[model samples]
Target: MVTAALALCVRTGAGAVIAATVFLTVLSVTLGGSVLADTPLWLPAMPAWPLTATGARLPVALVLGALLLTVSTGLAHRELSRAASR
Candidate 1:
C-alpha cells in the first residue's frame, strides 16, 4: 500500500504524506502478523491486545487500500494541475 501511495505522491504535492504514513503503518502491522481472529468482513474488529491472527490483518488491508485509492486520486489531480499550468 505504501508503494502505491508513494507513487501517487510522486505526482501530487506533499499533502499525501499523512495518508501515506497512516497506510504504511497499518500495512506494516498487518503484514507483521499481529491482529484479531475470525473478524467479520464488513466491520473493523478490535482484536484482543497482544493477539496475533490473520483475521486481524483484514482491517489494516482495507485501510491501506483506501489510502492507496485516495493518494492515487490526489496524484491524478496534481498531474492535471501540472498539465494545466504548462
Candidate 2:
C-alpha cells in the first residue's frame, strides 16, 4: 500500500519503487543483523530494530501503517477533488 501510494499519488514509477525497496530491505537486514550480532556499530541496536525484544514489533508496524494510510488517504482525497473539478 505504501509503495502503491508512492507510485500513484507521488507519481513514482513502479520500477523505481521496486528497485528502491529491494535496496532498502537488503540494507536494513544487513545493518540489523550487524547490530544484533554485537558488532561495532555507530549506534548499537539500530538499523535492525523494531527490536529483538519479545512481542514488541506489532505496535510499531501498526502505528507506521496507520500513518502511511493517513497520508495515502490525503493524497487520494486531493486527487479525487482534482478530478471532480475537471
TM-score leader: 2
Cα lDDT tens digits for candidate 1, 1-86? 34445556656656776776666557545643443234332233222212432466657756755776798677666766776798
Q: How many backbone clashes does candidate 2 have?
A: 1
- Tens digit per residue, CA lDDT, model 2, 1-86: 56344636445456766776676567667755654434333123323445432255546555755776788777767765666687
- Candidate 2 backbone collisions, by pair: 32-48
What's the lDDT for candidate 2? 0.54
**Which stretch of 10 consecutive residues in model 1 shows the poorest summed lDDT?**
41-50
Q: Candidate 1, residue 42: CA error in Å? A: 21
Candidate 2, 21: how far from true, in Å? Answer: 1.5
Per-model root-mean-square deviation over C-alphas: 7.6, 5.6
